[model samples]
Target: MGLDDIKRRIAAAEERAGRAPGSVTLIAVSKVQPEGRVTAVLDAGHRVFGENYVQEAQGKWPDWRNRWPGVELHMIGPLQSNKAKAAVDLFDAIHTLDRMTLARKLAQQADQQGRSPHLFIQVNTGDEPQKAGILADELPVFLSSCHDLGLSPSGLMCIPPEGHDPLPHFRLLRRLAHDHGLPHLSMGMSADFESAIAEGATHVRVGSAIFGDRA
Candidate 1:
């Protein structure tokens, strides 16, 4: 689908959720997509994108950044502590901050590099052991630790279990953000983004619906 089509979908979701126009930020997920596809997206005037891997983003985005000003990149996949500096340097925001070790690494690197992207604490709302997010019950303390480390996180993010209804997880994330005074909610994907909007998502990461299926 094209930019206009995605914008219309987001707009429709916002209207259904009683949100004013432009309240939700649409992040075009460019993970695993080639340069030509990304170029097409840029040519279409989209400035925000999401990537799942640091190495892949490093390989492609520097050139893209040089050519297109004001492009914002978000790291939306699991972040390793060793890659914290690279991630901090490349992304404008990070949506997968789940552990204290990585948070500390990011904080140190961001301070040293003199740049810090907006941080979001990822919560495993469904309590799935295999997921890479902090469990829901542990969020409070982890959030506090981030604040103590001066990360100053701005929101919460989650990937609800695949086959389950995602509304509850979205709602839980919304409440967590509110209780923590976080203003952004980076939840949902192509399938449940509309429902995520209904639960007050400020940023929705959409991949397939916008760029077609990844190879």
Candidate 2:
């Protein structure tokens, strides 16, 4: 499929969900994707990109940023403590703020750097142990700490377990956002995004659905 197709699907899904459409941001996940594909999307008017690997994002950000000054970069992958400083520099939004150490460092570094982007708490709403996120039961404590650290915990992001219905996880996230009074919900991806949109996803990451299968 193409970028237009992806946008159409998101719009239709929002309509089906009885929610207003076109409000949600579609982040073209360029993890493992070549620069040519990303460039094509950029030419096609996509400005926000999500990357999973720090090295990959590092390789791309400088050039992409120079080419499109207003382009936004979001880190949608698991981040290590060692890479926290670099991640803060590269990402316009850090989507996997799970631990306190990383959270504290991010706030301090952003304060030091004097210019860091938005931050989002990653929730293992799927309750997957292998993921890099706080458990659902542990989110409030995490968010409170993040607030204390001065990081704007604008929203929540999650990757649901494979083969499981993502709605439950997505719905849980939306509820958590409402309970916390956060307006953003960065759920959904290539496969189950329609359901995510139906469940009120404020941001959806589309990779292969836009660029075709990866090599």
Candidate 3:
């Protein structure tokens, strides 16, 4: 599993799904990997990457961005309200907009900074108790609240319950996004990305398949 292989698979998935070439953005999740592995991917010309923590990204990406032009970073992990400001500044997109407090913080930060990153509302399609996402049933209200607060999310994201069939979850996310009129669907990872593409995923986060297992 390497970058080119993953990309070829993505292209095939898009073809099977009737999506245009390059419709799916492959976000190489670089969180928790060694810097050398990240640089290898960067050297391979992968500019779009994902990070989990604000502090870890803040520590490394500024220098990397200067080294590699056109780099885009996405925040693909749980975000705390206190770190909203830094996350806003560092990430080009944030995929875990699940709570009102975080949404309010992001809105305020966007106002102060005069620019906002792309947003994706995380929906708990499986309704897991420990996950960091809004329950599917609550999305209408949550999305309405986000709109009232001036935060217009571009899509919907979800991490299906581990070890279960992911197709159902992916289909659920697709439905939610369609119902809400959102165009992007960030609902896949390394294992189920092909299924997600079939279900209309616009973004697939691949970490180990590209960089190998975390160090």
Show pairs that collide, candidate 1: none
The TM-score values for the models, in the order shown, are 0.98, 0.95, 0.99
Q: How much lDDT does candidate 3 score? A: 0.94
Local distance difference test, candidate 1: 0.92
Candidate 2 residue lDDT tens string, 1-215: 89999999888888888887677899999988877988999988789999988998898789988987789999988888888889888889988888999998898889988877787788988777777788988988888888888887889888888898787899899999999988899999999888888888889988999998876
RMSD of each: 0.9, 1.2, 0.7
Q: Which residue pairs collide, candidate 3?
A: none
Best by TM-score: 3
- Segments of candidate 2 deviating more than 4 angstroms: none
TM-score of 2: 0.95
Per-candidate Cα lDDT values, in order, are 0.92, 0.87, 0.94
Candidate 2 RMSD to the real structure: 1.2
Selected candidate, larger lDDT, 1 vs 3: 3
TM-score of model 1 (CA atoms): 0.98
Better of 1 and 2 by lDDT: 1
